[model samples]
Target: MTTQTLDGVTVNTQANVYFDGKCVSHGIALADGTKKSVGVILPSTLTFNTGAPEIMECVAGSCEYKLDGTDNWVKSTPGEKFSIPGNSKFDIRVTESYHYICHFA
Candidate 1:
């Protein structure tokens, strides 16, 4: 697997899931109204400026995130997806190293 940084965030990707020997990070939209899929490996902590404005699921690892800077962390573990509005400033604290596949519309 290889780890790369995007927008100041680190993401690790498995080498097998690539195309033409290039790392597969972003995807194209299909005619069936489906956009694409992206895989990410989050570390212990991550801070972001904007994100999806909807309920997102966490397939692996747990995350401690908060929409506001109140020291309150929203726990997001395996089988749990949290709702986060877009354009909301937030910070993510992963209790354990985690990996997830995120789908975009």
Candidate 2:
């Protein structure tokens, strides 16, 4: 898959902070007005609560995650994606720095 750049989109550079600064993301709006974030996670375990459903695409590296109400952890690598439901929380563990694109729906 190819990554599309959102022209004329204003990015929120200080949004979506997690793990006390270990994980951070910037918000961007698509041409159709869909919101998303491109972020990087450091090697750490973090839990995040979502207000809307999210599809996280692994752009570089990999990470393991367990969704809310799920006991099994799943691994996602570059080009792989995982979905999380709205109003839910999920845990993620990363060994190395992981880069991802988060699409909010």
- By TM-score, how accurate is candidate 1? 0.56
Query: Across residues 13-104, which tens digit of lDDT does each residue of candidate 2 receive?
Result: 67788778789889988767888899999999989899999999988888999999999999999889999999999999999888999988
Count of backbone collisions in candidate 1:
1
Candidate 1 lDDT by residue in tens digits, 46-102: 555546554545665566777764778767767675655677767776656555444
Candidate maximizing TM-score: 2
Worst 10-residue lDDT window for candidate 2 reads: 1-10
The numbered model that scores best in lDDT is: 2
TM for every model, in the order presented, reads 0.56, 0.88
- Model 1 residue 76 lDDT score: 71
Candidate 1 residues lying further than 4 Å off, grouped into runs, are: 1-31, 103-105
